[model samples]
Target: MIRTSAAALAFLVAALPATAGERMNLGIGTIFDNDAMGDGDDRWRSGSFAISHFRGPEWRGKLPEAPGSFIEWRFRSEIITPENVSGTAITSDRRYVGVLSAGLHTHFQRNGAEVSLGADIVAIGPQTGLDDFQDAVHDLIGTSEPRSAVNQIGNDIVPTVTLEVGRELALAGNGHVRFRPFVEAQAGIETLVRIGGDFTFGGTGMGAFRMRDVVTGQRIDGVIGTADTGLSFLVGGDIAYVADSFYLPSRLGFDLTETRNRLRAGLQYDGEIASVFYGVTWLGEEFEAQPESQVVGTIAINLNF
Candidate 1:
């Protein structure tokens, strides 16, 4: 997975249900670039699948002060190709890497704001099948050269924690037109201090605003942003500053340092039984000597019960 800033992490944590909420949500999203449209690099791709289980009355009874809470678990996967992306040889740095990760989180909401915390663990290397899968996919399409998987991280395990603070804003509203804006800031072992916001329109569900807090994963609250089961549409943009990341490539036998900015734009629609979200993001160069930054497109779908 890409290393991002604190603002991204904060936004993600704020979007989830706070440990004792009323509903559950299941969703999947892909973070990629316009390579699918033949307009951008195809080297970096990532996806996330997640589900939120309601905290329920039994759990709320034990913690009455925070009745709307839930446990969220997510599956994360990613593939990186520095050489292919930059179109240059990379020495010492990893050439490619495939990663699979999972995390368990709990969140709470109160007075139009939310607090969240969670932990995730990562596994990297060939066993992850990210590189081979990409190779097979590209072979089917007949690309120039197949990409090699990176082994620098070497089957290591990385554990990180998540924390965030978020606020929901109701700027204006009417039967047909409504506006809501929000802001959040948070820190993760992966992202030091990320901050971002969103402005939403159309309906009054979580689906009415930007649904993703992170480029690759959906936040617990954003997942329920439209939990009321209504027809809604949303459009929004976000920006963030990331301090450092263990996920990005490093050199000199040390983890690389980063403090770049990230920007994203997205649109979404929430319906009665299912919803869809499409978004795109630009990441600042991960390494100083790198040629250019990265652009990725993401799509998310959910089944509501």
Candidate 2:
């Protein structure tokens, strides 16, 4: 996975302990849509990775202000070559799927509102040399859906767990403009419940909650050595209502038909060393022999030294 995320970003810049208001960054991304530019069987091609950690405010009197404690890491890939999903693939899915994640947050202040608490972990599978080159392209085009190979499920290791809560609004008071709203729930093997919101203009305040910049603003006001070179932009969106999604196609077994609203929209740019984002997703209609309706396109870039 890119040499294990470049050796975990050089071991977190060598055992994390550099503080002039520490806040590091690195990101990358891409995604495709239109059923992967039209080749059917719903396709996808994605690549992403990110790493960010912040703990500024000069450790707030030895760590206590909690303005959203942070730690993050991510990786993703959903490539299905042949230049975009096709070329005689005998069903039951999984050509290339990979995901790895880690997220954590913590912010404080109750009665006066400004709360946050979070957790995350996700790991999907498939990537053994692209599943052995897609089993040699399905053994050189040799099978025809043995009922989807006796109903799929086995890209190995699927894990999930998430929990969330957030609220941080700063409408207008020199903090520029801000709003962060959230609600979340998740479970192993894949289950869900989600609610979201985001709106930011300027810097600071974006305590991660799906409207993703993958969380920034020094990871929600942890405050780094005063510097953001000004200029900023953001707009966020989300809407999800999924019941289960164990890699679709009727939980990988077939018998299609499973979709319960999922949408997203985004645009962002945070400067002072590059940060950019663009997202778009719409999915609803996952089967019944594939009834269309699915779109995705995500883009990201971040670099801050």
Best by TM-score: 1
> RMSD of model 2, in Å?
16.8
lDDT of 2 by residue, 82-128 (tens): 22343454454343344445544444445544443434444454432
Query: What global local distance difference test value does model 1 have?
Result: 0.50
| Model 1 per-residue lDDT tens digits across residues 1-305 | 33433333455456554543444343333333343422266654333333333232332211222522444555666666654542454563445666777665565566656555666666677778666777777679877544345343456556666666566565656433443334444443356565555445545454322234454333212333434554444444444455555555343443443455565556556665556666666666555555666666665665433
Cα lDDT, all candidates: 0.50, 0.43
Best by lDDT: 1
Off by over 4 Å in 1: 1-39, 44-68, 83-88, 92-94, 150-152, 174-191, 204-213, 216-243, 249-258
Give the Å shift of residue 93 in candidate 1: 6.6
